[model samples]
Target: MWHTVVGAVGLVMGLLPHVLHHIGLLAGTAFVAGSGGTALFGALGLLASVPMLIRLYRRFGSWVAPAVGLLVFAAMFSLSAFVIGPAISGAEGDVTTPSPAPAVDHTDHPGH
Candidate 1:
């Protein structure tokens, strides 16, 4: 059923980062490197869950329960990917590497 499928997807979305990391497919807190498949899937699930929720809403003529669960999952997913994960892995702020040192001016010193 759509409800079951959507619920499962929401669960996965909520745990995407930890799951991917645990499975060894991703290494960093930032978005998945290169293809970004896990992030992509989580994003897609967030988008797709809407219509499924609507369908469930129409079918049951009620909205609160399913909406709350899905919304919570989506929020958790977004927060984890965009905030918590980065903070946990120390990737939240910009990383500044010192610029290469300027070439020595030994010419002026003349090998002194």
Candidate 2:
């Protein structure tokens, strides 16, 4: 009973960030844009969910709870990344335009 409730809560919590990001309420960080940083961020999320996973494990007394948790995370991530995000923000996602290049200085040039 408690496990089911925890799993449902976990699913909703996991989906929250995606919903926020898709709706432009959340901003992306440069660190998370890099490959290594992305991995680190994922690891951090996993670590953060450890307590919930533990509770699920204790209740189920098997690997099923943890597996379900992982699946829920993946499903939420994919649903947002592929479907909701594109629908809300378009196919380009939350891309920002690049800033203009700085003007070149001509004072130091002898020809100038």
TM-score leader: 2
Stretches of model 2 off by over 4 angstroms after superposition: 1-29, 32-41, 92-112
| Candidate 1 weakest lDDT stretch, 10 residues | 26-35
Per-model TM-score on C-alpha atoms: 0.40, 0.45
* Backbone Cα, N, C clashes tallied per candidate: 0, 0
On residues 5-42, what C-alpha lDDT tens digit does candidate 1 reach at each position?
86887787668645665554335534554237546867
Can you tell me which runs of candidate 1 are displaced by over 4 Å?
1-6, 25-42, 56-80, 93-95, 99-112
User: In model 1, how large is the Cα lDDT of residue 70?
Assistant: 91
Instruction: Please list the C-alpha lDDT of all candidates, in the order they appear.
Output: 0.68, 0.66
Model 1, CA-based lDDT? 0.68
lDDT of 1 at 88: 79
TM-score for candidate 2: 0.45
